[model samples]
Target: MAEEDEGPQKAVADPETYRESLDAWMKMQMPAAEDLRVHAVDMPRATGFSNETVFFSATWSQAGEQTTHRYVARIEPPDGGLFPIQTRECEISCELQHRIMSAIKDSGVAPIPELLPFEPDTGVLGRPFFVMEFIEGLVPADVPRYTQAGFLVDDATPADRERMVRDAVETMGALAGLDWRTMGLDWLDVKAKGQPSLQDQIELYRDYVDRELSGREHPILSASLDWLDANAPSAPVGISWGDSRLGNMIWKNYRCASVCDWEAVSLCPPEADIGWFVMFDRMSYDDFDVPRLEGFPTREEQVAIWEAKSGRTVGHTIDYWEIFGAMRFDAIMIKLGDRMARAGIVPAEPGISIDNGTTDGLGRLLERQGVSL
Candidate 1:
């Protein structure tokens, strides 16, 4: 796998270094006489552009008893990250972790790993990182694409694959139905410069293109943003899982066991999330040559389940939202590609850009909208 081959070489911290730092921190948290030893401190090959996740096992002795636990540490990029802190309106990563976990508490929509602690002081490690219980389940890989190579397609029965898709969409629907303000998630409602949250996202992406990818011309993204501005939907506002997709979920027993990665949680139209989820699925097949798992819900079936569970119609705006989804991916890939190039992961100019698939896919959608890129 590309991730397995490249991840270890590109990792920012060594396993030995991680264990030393984590053990020291854990020892301080335990009783004075208690012993805290960390082992199996390996960064998962699933590290992505946004955050670094490392898994480890810890054994501690306290009051004549010893216990061992598996945990995950999600760390912010020590240097500049793909999503820069300056571009965001929320607090730092640690604070955001607390806020998101607090909002979803007792919601009963799906299981989430228990958030342990947010270490602000970088003295223990080079950068602040938060710990959570390590969820044990099947997480679809992205680099090779799950459809192309993963336990989901390689091992699971067709029925289980179908259940995975349906349950994942249902989880999204439950989230869209959530009352953010009632759940005390109003903190995610940042100042949108007097514009609706959806509009704010459009502007934000456009700004990212201009400032983050200066001297670059992304015709498809530019066209999609313009179309969004012209055809802004009047859909009801709701919570949007910014990175909504089946890949972000941990599956066990053919159902979504846990939904993780709330970095892009926001107040936006419900369609925004559905669009993202749909486009990601579409890309897996259309761009990567990865076939959709048999028995999974079709696009129409997914929408039907979403409407039933969310208790709202996507109406005629579903197409528009999907286009927005493709565009959003393109915008983020602009940064992702640049990051990889700077790190020498890939050449400065590849035949097809890192975001080529998403950009081309969005172009086809634009033609349907009578817009040219």
Candidate 2:
């Protein structure tokens, strides 16, 4: 979920165009509001290079009274965005996101924005998109590195920061505890084996790396994949919030108000999500050699909180999952870097995407674990 230095040049179409299209669409959804208007359409600067996210406000009439509501639209990227294979193949479609969030909202297991119906017709906005109630809360900014600057570091007291961490972990635990089958989310098990096996998750990424590389050699990823195949551990199949991190949550009153970003939602073990959460903390602080902000719980402390909240044991298995998280992240970087280069946001050259901090971190992790390249 790393943000590029410069915003993607064409993350969305013209705001005016969106305003027009969305206005008409919202009318259909609310036929009673004859004077409904969509305005203030915009793309947030801090959004990562994943789905194109647009925020706008709509004003309409109800009972002869004017009312306004803010909403966010998640659009499919023209270039398939990050995780190109998943988006292109419909493994991670907007409809799936809508269904997942809707289930989670009904389960009340976690906080999610209220959603509208999913719009599968690309003609609505040039791509499939879903509109949801815009949540009013502060999201940890990815562009500025929340550790260095943001309400997370600059304004929040130590106690507040601690509370944020605890609350986020608790939310994750709640989500992990949910039963996908009971929630009618069995379709997320892409392999359709009753549940998504750990091996299937690993192979999915291996296939992703191969497709993203297109024959380009990535030694660190290859070695990590080999190690994973040989040392895969068994764990309960549970819900994975795919990209779990502080940046993905919207906070209100130092507590998680809404959980966003469901493109990576899967049926992997809960450990995968925890691994991602911890791995990103390392990337934000340790990888950059930045001192972690005061008051945030240590890695062990955070895991302990998760254990208590989720009622699950996470022992050495976390080490394996952390490496798994790193590998998945590195694989995504390959596609992300290429997308940036092609957009002229970064230099276009060989190895421009692969030879970077993510790969380096993956290499160091393998070395520390005695996995030789």
Candidate 3:
């Protein structure tokens, strides 16, 4: 469910104190700086659903000169997140996240942001977090659904949109093209549990959906999940950036400047990433009931571009993964919806029809594949 962001949301943490803490922490990290101070810290208007992000500017004097830097910190949720605490054996640690990006820094798949550090200790920020060099660029709005209205839709040229899409697809291809084994990232591999990787993921989501709904039946979501199990793809696991899409990319010059949001990064067939990329892009238009913006590649065009860039034929398996992607996002929305309901933000609809758009989208995708839902 790619729901629109109503407006600029507030930060979960205070800016002034957080900046002071960050200033002290960075000073310790830089032993050489005699006088290290954070000039300012600002929580950008845009906030992510899962993590609390903070931006800071600091100036430190080493010897007789002063140097300045801007950094971004991604703090993990303390209680829990939208998704379940990933199974430890198959989980992504903050250290692993840092390693993943570091390994691919030279791959040309995407502009890799420089990572500052991965702090596992929570005492500093009341939760575990990591930092990266701040990248100045425009990101398509997730809350506003870029297609509905935004800097991207309102001001970006049609040619700019096309280049953005192309760059994103190519970046995804570059990520999938990397040698995971050589990169020493085999720790991310999950045993299929006597089932295929695709099916394993579906069951995980099914269980989460059950938890989210408290065993309440989500007919359309359940139907889509069942269809995915019945029509699972046979492709082997590869490096699938779990949250692949244009919105996840920070853009400059209409091309991907840096790829963000790797919390759901996983090992799945390349089709999984392709499916996510296409489904999420479509959700912006589908959920908003708007026409696809001009120059943005169609689903077919996206797949073809990825195939050309990654050198892997999408073949017929993409539909199965697309359903899986929808189901995955559906389960997330269910949990997120439940969270909102508890907070009195929205009514808790028993039928969970609020996810109808996502389910409807999934149903149509299944039908297009000739699978009865």
The residue-by-residue lDDT of candidate 1 on 72-165, one tens digit each, is: 8887664434432312545465557545765675676657887766786655665667888887888888977887887877788888888888
Q: What RMSD does each model have against the real structure?
A: 5.7, 5.3, 6.1
Tens-place lDDT digits, model 2, residues 235-262: 7888888889999999999899999887
What is the clash count for each candidate, in the order shown?
0, 0, 3
**How do all models score by TM-score?**
0.88, 0.92, 0.88
TM-score of 3: 0.88
CA shift of 44, model 2, Å: 3.9
Model 3: residues with Cα > 4 Å off, grouped in runs: 1-12, 44-49, 84-86, 89-96, 106-108, 192-196, 350-356, 369-373
How many pairs of residues in model 2 come into backbone collision?
Answer: 0
- Residue-level lDDT tens digits of model 3 in 55-153: 888888888998888988877643345654335633434545565677667566678898877786666876667889998999888777889888778
Which candidate leads the pack in TM-score?
2
